[model samples]
Target: MAVRTQVKFYYDVLSPYAWFGFEALCRYQKPWDLDLQLRPINLGKIKKESGNISPGPCADVFKGSLFFPDVQRTSEMMELPYKPLKDFEESVFIKGSLPTQKTLAACQILYPDNMEELTRQSWLGLYSHDMDMTDKGNILQFAEAAQIPDVDKLLEFSVGNEAKQQLISNTTEALESKCFGAPWFMVTNPKTGRREKFFGQDRVEMLGWVLGKEYVGHHPSQ
Candidate 1:
C-alpha cells in the first residue's frame, strides 16, 4: 500500500490569519490526497515558549486594514465570500472558555460531516459574527446559527474528561512537532518518521510542492 501523507495543522481560534489558512486547507483537500491532522493548542502557550507577544491585536488591525481591497481583488478572482474585517475588531477578543469550547464543539460537528466546515465555522464564529467565542452563551448562539443543536450537550463534551485529555494529547503532539505558532502544518512520514513543517497559509502551496503534488495558487490578492 502506498503510504498516506499526513498534514497536521496547528491552530488557535484567536487568529484571523489562522482562519485564512483553514480555508486554504479546505481548498487543497482533493488535489493533494491530504490526510489532515488537526492539532489545536493554545497560541498563548506557543507564544510563551517562543518569547513572543500575542499577534491578536496587531494582526487583527492589519488584517482589517488590508482586508477590503484584498477581499475585492480576491473575490473577483475566486468565488469565496470577501467580507472585510474593518468593523471586526471586537470579535478578536479571545476569552479562554468560549473559544476553547467552540473550537472543540465545531470539531464535534465536523468530525462527522466534513472537517473542513468544522474548521471554517469555528473561524466564522470569531471573525465573521464578531462574537466572543469563549462565552458559553455566545458559543451556543453560534452553534445554533451553524445548525448544531444541543449546545448544552456539545459544551458538556467540550469540557468532559475525554475532551480535556485529547486536547492535552494534541498539545503534546504539537510541541513534539517542533512548532510553536499558529497556522502551522506538519506532515510525518509514517515509514521514515520524517516530518515536514510549513508555517503560515502562504506556505501551503509549498506543502503541495514538498509532497510531489501540483500547487493550486491562492488568490493573488492574498
Candidate 2:
C-alpha cells in the first residue's frame, strides 16, 4: 500500500487569500486523498523578521496586480464567498496571529477524534462567522456554534502558556522549514519523511500537481 501524503497548512486569518485557498482544500479533500496537517504560525513574527508590513501602499499594488484577482477567480470557480476588503476590526497585533493560534489549539483539541466536524467548524468560524477569533469569548461562541462539548477545556487550553509555546514552536518550525509567509503548504512523504513546500494562497493547482492530479487552470480575466 502506498503511504498517504501529509500536507502541512500554515495559515494567518488576516489574509483573505488564505481563506479562499483553505476552502478549496476542504472542497477537494476526498477527491485528492490528502491527510492535512494544520499548523498555525505567527505571521507577525515572520513579518518582523523579514521586514514586511500589511496594508501598506504595496498591498494596494498587489491587490490590483495579482492577489485579489486570483482569489476572485478562485472564489467564483468554487462558488465561495469573496469580499475584496471587508471591514475587519484591526488589531495592534500583526496579521491576525492570536486568533489563528486559538483556532489551532482548538483543532488540536478536536483532531483525530472529531476531525471532520472540527475541520468544518473551524473553517466556518474563520470565513463565515467573522468572529474576532483572538477573543476567548468569541472562541467560546464558536465552540458553541460547532456544538463541541468540551468548549471550556478547549478555551482554557487555548489561553494557557502551553498554547503560547506551541505557537512559538510552530512558528520556529515553519521558519526552519523555509517558509516566509502565510498559507504555506508542504507535502511530506510518509515513507521517507521527505518534504516539499509551496508558499502563498494561489498555489492550489501546484498542490494538486504535487499530489498527481490534473488541476483546473485559473487565471485573472483581463
Candidate 3:
C-alpha cells in the first residue's frame, strides 16, 4: 500500500495571498493525491511577534506601491479573482481575531470534503465582496452562503473555549514551525518521509515537484 502525502495549509483570511494560495492548492490536490489539511492562523500576531510588517504598509514607499500590482499579476496568472476591499487597511484591521476564530469553528463543524467550499466563500466574501467577517452577523451570513447547515450552531461553537484554544494553538504551532506569513504550506510525503515548507501561491509548481509531479512552469498565455 502506498502512503499518501499530506499538505498542511496555514492561512489567514486577512491576506489576499492566502486566498490565491488556497485556490491553487484546491486546484492541485486531487491531481496530486494530497491529503489536504487547512489550519487557521493569525497573521497579525505572527507579524507582530516576528517584527515584520506587511509589504503593503512597509516603510519603503516603492515596495508598498508594488504590493497590490503584484497581487493583481499573480491573481491573473492563477486565473483567480482579485479585488481590493475599500478601506481595507482601516476597516478590516479593526476586525481583530473574529475571522480566524470563525474559520476555526467552521473547520471543526464541517466535513473535510466541504472545507474548500467554505474557505472559498469566506475568502470571496471578505476580499471580493468586502463583507465584514469580524462582524458576527456577517459571519453567520457567510456561513449560510457556504451551505453550512447550521449557522447558529457554528456561531455558538465559535465563541466557545475549545474554538478559541484551537485557533491559539494553531497559531502558536505555525509560529513554532517558522511560518511568518499566511498561505504557508508544510508538505510531508509519507512514502519517502520528506517534509518541506513552501510559501506563496507562486510556489505551487515547486510543491508539485516535491510530490513527484512534473513541474509545468507558468505560461502567461495559458
Candidate 4:
C-alpha cells in the first residue's frame, strides 16, 4: 500500500484568507492523497512571539481598499463562500478570538476524526453566517454541524483550563515551527523526509509542486 503524503494546515479563524485556504485544502485532500491535519492557533499570540505585524482587513487606508476586492475575486476563483464579518471591529479587534480558538482546539482534542469538518463549520459560522463565534451557543452549533458525538460536553470542556492550555500549546507549536501568519502550510516531503513550510493563501500551487501533485490554481473540486 502507498503511504499517503502528510500536510499540516495551521490557521486562525480570524482571517478570511485562512477560510479560503481551509476550503481549498479540504477540497483537494482526497485527490491529492493527503493526510491533512488541521491545527487551530491564536494569531495574536503568533504575531507577538514572532515580532511580526499583521495587516488587518481594514488596517489602514491604502491596503484596506484592496482587501475586499481581492477577497471577492479569490473566493470566486476558489468557489468558497465569502462575506465580510457583520461586526468586524468586535470580531477582529475588541471581543477577540480566545474563546473561539479554545473551542476549536477542544474539538481537535476530543474529535480528531471530525477536525476538518468542525473547523469548516466553525469558520462558516463566523465568516459566512455572521455568527459571533465567541458565544458558546454558536460554538456548540458548530460542533453540532460537524456531527460531533457530544456537543454539550464539548462546549463545557471548551471553557475549562484544559482547552485554554491546549490552544496555548498549539500556538507555541506554530511559533516554534516558524509560523508568523494564519493559513500556514507544513508539508512533509515523502521521499526526502523533510518538512517544508509555506505561509499564506496564494501558496496552493507551490504546495502542489512540493507534493508532486498537479496544480490547477485552487482546488477545483470545490
Among all candidates shown, the one with the greatest lDDT: 4
Candidate 1 regions with alpha-carbon error over 4 angstroms: 56-98, 101-114, 141-151, 189-193, 219-222
Please estimate how well model 1 matches the true structure, expressed as its whole-model Cα lDDT.
0.63
99: Cα error in model 4, Å = 1.5
Pairs with steric clashes in candidate 1: 98-133, 98-134, 98-135, 99-133, 99-134
**How close is every model to the real structure, measured as TM-score?**
0.75, 0.77, 0.89, 0.94
lDDT of 3 by residue, 19-91 (tens): 8888877777666777888888778888888776676644468877888788888878776766876776664
Our model 2 lands, by Cα RMSD against the true structure, at: 4.5
Worst 10 residues of 4 by lDDT: 213-222
lDDT of 3 at 162: 72
Q: Per-residue lDDT of 109-212 in model 1, one digit per residue for the tens?
A: 43434345545666676555555666777666655655554556666677666666666666667777776687888877665678888777578777776677
Give the lDDT ranking, best first.
4, 3, 2, 1
What's model 2's lDDT at 61? Answer: 70
User: lDDT per model, in order?
Assistant: 0.63, 0.63, 0.74, 0.83
Backbone clash tally (model 1) = 5
Give the C-alpha lDDT of model 3: 0.74
State the lDDT at 19 in candidate 3.
87
Displacement of the residue 122 alpha carbon in candidate 3, Å: 0.9
Candidate 2 pairs with clashing backbones: none
Best model number under TM-score = 4
